[model samples]
Target: MEKRRAALRLLPVLLGLALAPAAAPACEPALNGTRVESSRFVLSYQSTPIEVGKHFALDIAACSKPGAPEPESLKVDAQMPEHRHGMNYAAKVTKTGPQRWRAEGLLFHMPGRWELSFELRAGGTSDVMRNSLVVASAPVRFTEEEKRSILSHGPWPPKLVPDPSNRVSGNPEAIAFGERLFFEPRLSGTGSVLCATCHVPYRGFHDGRARGFGLEDVDRNTQSVVDARFNRWFGWDGANDSLWAQSIRPLLDPREMRSNATTVSRFIRNNPPFRTGYERAFGKKPPEDDEEVLVDVGKALAAFQETLVSGRTAFDDYRDALESNDVREMQKYPEDAKRGLKIFVGKGNCGLCHFGPRFTNGEFADTGIAFFARKGVVDPGRQGGIKKLRSSGLTLLGRFNDDPAQATALATLYVEAQHRNFGEFRVPTLRNVARTAPYMHDGSLATLRDVVRHYSELDEERLHGDGEKILKPLHLSEDEVSDLVAFLESLSAR
Candidate 1:
């Protein structure tokens, strides 16, 4: 039994030797049907039609020089010429007989002319042959449902409205003032950690930590501010209704800026640059109320942050290519990424919550991540968020809100926490997601693969009782997982 198993393992090799030619120009046997015959060997496969997106197989027979050692092995693969990409699925080759081989598991995903190539080897001799076939299928089409889903994620570089909640929202002078304040460290109680301390510019504005660090530590991971203006909710918990209000929480947090509203007010009021910038941006004088000044600072910070939108990504390029029906351009995108995208909107169901231009629906969900922050602490997530928003006087209900109609503030007024809100964190944007790691609200997962595996083999027991029922273990194959990760990484901004 052991000898038979060993022979089986070596079978492909032996078959290749039996068919390999002695010399590059050695005579090959004549054969018919979808074949390329050369002096060294004859390579042939079935002439059956290969419809795109459909799996098909054929016998790849080879005949070598008469005196050549029995062809040792045969290997077969296919590539789309225009796409310049190989088949997403690997082809399997097996020996059927002397100088005869069968290849299976061939699936051409795209419609285009394809090159079927073969490698034949015997002992130290080897030869290769190629045959071309135009494999095509029905023209590219998508259901109305799919088209809507795909289109919603784009219309890129969304129009910027610097600060809809504040009069300075789109003011250029305010933006400049805010830009200066963003890099100021004295604003923090530590007098060293700037806003850019956690939100580094080059690393896609992500601090790249499992949890953010400031004067002490931040419980959750630091989310990138790239394209942050699109987010209706702020923070992993959606604790703040506006970016301005969101900016204040970090400053007041003991672990973050560790500064009081009074201190922030004094610092800005005392600094000539800040005062001058503030006067030019918001008017001649800063607000007298300490708390009000602090709020204004947050607004300035928000103005600058809104400018940090992400640039175009590889996925964006591919999406544009698909839109224009530019086959040549589209082929440049990796097959792995395309397959991963199919899994994303299709089998993976990631598109449901991660939707829209920035790839988030701006909602919260309990996606099975643990809630514990410390030994006795548990994050109440969006539940806590709702409570905090309702009690905060700085909300849209307050005088700080510039929108008298309070259009964007309606969501806050209507929001109510239920059992489902517990453990729910905001859905983050997928743009530049590849640069922001480790992932998840808590950043417990270390890599994109780890996040994929977490969902692929989700722990049902850990999921919140009222969490999203749509989530389930994917049970994805290894290749599928790889493709999915590749696709997600493609979302990174250039």
Candidate 2:
């Protein structure tokens, strides 16, 4: 009887031990149909249950038959649930064992549930697996002083500055004439193309291409003509010192309008409607020669482009309420978006680069884009622009300029700042950013979530300029990133 009792006690202990491992949960079940034996593979990460306005990292691992042809190569991908977009995860692979692999990447500004997927391939075989996780909303926590500071500001106005040379700030006739010139396809070398071809009115006045496709392929992205008048300097490289000067570039570029002074002059003088319009605006008949007509064309185009200002968005509404101390209106915005706004201005420190009503300081920075095709061979960016400005006889200070005296001063200042402007590209406005995909000067990023994520977990090596130190890892929670993206989306003109 003693032996039987002892055996029973031992049996109970053994049973408990055997059950412990099973009860611990078997690695959350590699669900989404992940098959271990297959040479081909597909897998996804589990969704992260977090909020907007945060940052997160994803790491996935896989094991295969030791000698199974090394499973070709491992691939990982992720998709945002709410936005129906793919996140730009800077993926990297590490070998954990002979047949085991781990893939990792950072998700910067996306919020809400996201799906991660993995794929494995070996010997013409493949398999896939997927999983989802929820990203929650972030909490708002602003200080009293912060609230006071926000409340002290006022709403931004739609201000237009008068042109120093012509005193034509808001001339409706000039704008109307400029609008006609903008849409006229005859202006280009290929009559099929017009200013509207490169600066599409629907696409924020910018053609959605990497570099513009002109008479031939041009080597620069077409800058947005919207709100060009407000800009102190013009062009991606700031080659043109004024809006009118910038307008003349496309007309002369072989790949753009390809129309010389003579051709443009002939078109304007021969076209009765254009002649009448020009006469009304300039108080003179269209110039008999091409040089004079070309100048008028530049001026007209600038006038039309000046009207492309941004309209109010949800962020602006919230901003106005905050400025007026209207607590009720301010409270109407999503809590996550508000927190994101805080991150943008404070913790995230985005305001340092993106400031003022237009969300840009009109400055340039080297954001570390891979500009060089071959190692050690760099695209000299603004440096090239400086050289072009000096050599091109088209600048305001040059013989072709309508106001060479003032243009000369502007060009001189720009040249003096050449050292400070190397590799620098202008800061783009964030309005309607959601609609324009493939971010940055080079269109390197594919989506806004990717952009937010990039800024959230910026690679220090990529920011090859003076401000890299300021853009440290935000260490934001997943929710915080989402909130920041939400706030940015709210800035889009609806």
Candidate 3:
């Protein structure tokens, strides 16, 4: 029995040596297939790369050697030697000629070491030939289009441009003052809640909760402050055209800090540390007008928030490698991630909304998630945002804007609320997405997988009739779902 097992192990090697042409490279498949031979039979076969989760077929030609007894039949099969499990699907065999055959419907669903076995039987005895290979954990290759799409998500840490509407946007002194203001709990009505209370720096700058909790519950998810400098609009509803205006919102909201302009202005003017920082930032003491002081406070806070850019992620490394065609660096990225990225750029159509280096188009869309805040009240999303922007004095259209030309206010000047905008919400950056969970405007989904599943099984009936017809059910397989999640996780810092 031991001798027989040892002979079986040497069978494929012996057959390969006999069949390979004199000039052919050893242990490599030829253009058509790998050829093998033995004393009784000679066989040649070809197969595509045996990728996990993809269906493939095999072609084979076999015949008895001259002066050797002809085999009565041939059988083909495969198994994972360590796993002791064969393929889930059986191949359908077809005999095309006296010495040629085809096998269809072969599939490998898992990645690992696998062995393909070809058995030839004559009289009452059988000879089995086996070939072994490994299924890679990452994908084998990417199409040119796929490579292009993947490359577009990178270069990481986009250029920082000062806000034209806020004069102190790039001032180092203002940024320092802003940092102090960020952690100042006195800015809140409760004196215990700070901007850091909700936008926790250690927690990816957005408190990891389903909904933001300031003095009370906020209706939407607390988006990360990281990479906010790149946004065209702020907040889930796109309600604030400027980051400063958006900053002032939570300060006065009844459910948030609940501090009025008077409370905020007086606190900054009276508090020695704040007063000194404020003076340094603005080049003077706090102004007499309470509203002006409050706006300045928001501006200082915005200045601080602008610097919270996230670090480079694994995907960025892969993207850079791909851009330079560095095969060695690209291979360091997991194969599962590559497969997942293919789905993201191709079948998922996620790139349409989550585009650019920021991985967001900086716009709003109604993704068919329910918008009802309660049984009787619905969150009016972008519609409410445009309405609020039109009425707000903090906008670039207002006198508070430092820009004489109001150059940055174009989106504010022309944006009007439409019926289709009712459920539309701003697209958030995918940077640090894996860390900021409880996703969506309402924070309804709990995980990255949940968010993917939401799109995978989207209900078209719930979508706005007048909205862009981009979303539909993905109906992804289990492997596809896992692949997409892996890709999304790669977008985050390691």
Candidate 4:
């Protein structure tokens, strides 16, 4: 039994020896930094400020005591003792000199106390030495121009205004009725799906799927309705001019709820709870006309969704501080994020399209994403959106519009589809962006890092001839990528 145990132990050492490289690259002499000592050896390590989530390297050196054998191998590692988790990636160690080594690809993914370990193996024995480190973010000081650019992003939670085209837009009863309908599965033809299936409240109002699924898969990602009240146009293709009209599309689509106006109105009229709620919202019994009841139900849904605005975030506090010239308050923001903000407003040119408190221009643009839906099918995007908008009777210019003068209908009337608008899509709001993953209209990019990389190495050749002139390859360094991701994460609510 003892012999078997001894042989099993030797297996690991033999495997490690077989896996090691024939030669390790040379490194400079000992790093003159933090030093630690063991009974048989003195160890020293040097590294930059270990900020959370940023990758860094370590230079290490060991001095053996007189008459003691040098270590045959070495390994370095770090872990959070309290959380019982290590780094997402392992460090690659290389012996640089007789007593020096370099460890690369070390990253601390979270802010907390970490226990760093260095293992020395010699004469069939190993010694593990450890040191504790406290990691926190250090913010940078901003220049006058940078401060001005940062301040423009927000004072946050912008004041809500009632929609001029929806008479019951701000009514509490209408909002309550809409809330009930939002979760009512019987509103669908199959009585199995509801708005919450795709716009799940817990998942940042997103379904977290690459494409939405109701009765079947839809060709686009499920967008959040968190701040729908502030939108100028609705959907990725901007097919609907009003939120209520957009709400009605899913009800009628065969791939979604698959219910006609007659079925929807009959369900609302026959159900006691829905009937009572509709009466409270519309100030009367459910209407006899199916089309009128359907539009009213849509208006009620829009009223409730308008109240779903996101809360204030860290970026808002920093922007507010910058506006008032409160240096101390501004300093609380991360240094890497400040660097990212500079890139965003200046070199990145992102603010040109994603400016304002909502962090969007509320317009459409072609960002070079592929428009192919299948082998021979194209999504058509804004071009098709314009065609649908012009043909639909549920627009701001239609009879259902509550505005007497039709003040908001001008855009709907004047919007002509141009050849350049072929693959254009609505620019999404950036508020609470970190929470909404599987990004883009098709949900192709899976992470904020991936989205940043897409722009960093943008394929300018892939862009259409009429694409936005401001877009170009950023050629960002890895550090800059990390900084930008940090800045974007700051936009999320705490």
lDDT of 4 by residue, 1-494 (tens): 99999999999999999999887322222567777766666788999657776788999898766655687788999999998989888999999988888899999876679989999887788878899989875445557876677777877888778999999999999999999999999989999999999999999999999889999998898999999889989999999999999999999998999998999999999999999999999999988999999999999999999999999888898899878879899888887787788778878878889988888999998887888765688988889999999999899999999999999888898999999898889999999999889988889999999999999999987777777788888999776788899899999888
If the candidates were sorted by their lDDT against the true structure, best first, what order would they fall in?
4, 3, 1, 2
Find the candidate with the highest TM-score and give its number: 3
Alpha-carbon deviation at 46 in model 1, angstroms: 6.0
Per-candidate TM-scores read: 0.77, 0.68, 0.80, 0.76
Clashes of 1: 18
Candidate 2 structure, TM-score to reference? 0.68
- Ten contiguous residues minimizing lDDT sum, candidate 1: 135-144
Deviating ranges (above 4 Å) for candidate 3 = 1-49, 54-88, 91-104, 114-133, 137-140
Residue 254, model 4, lDDT: 87
What is the C-alpha local distance difference test score of each model?
Answer: 0.82, 0.68, 0.86, 0.88
* Backbone collisions counted per model: 18, 46, 2, 3
Model 4: lowest-lDDT 10 consecutive positions: 23-32
Cα lDDT of model 1 by residue, 234-292, tens digit = 99888888989998888899898898888898888899988999888888688889898
Report the lDDT tens digits of candidate 2 across residue range 136-227.
Answer: 55556667755544433224446567665333435788889999999999977667779888788888777888667777776556777766
Please tell me which model should have the higher TM-score, number 1 or number 2.
1
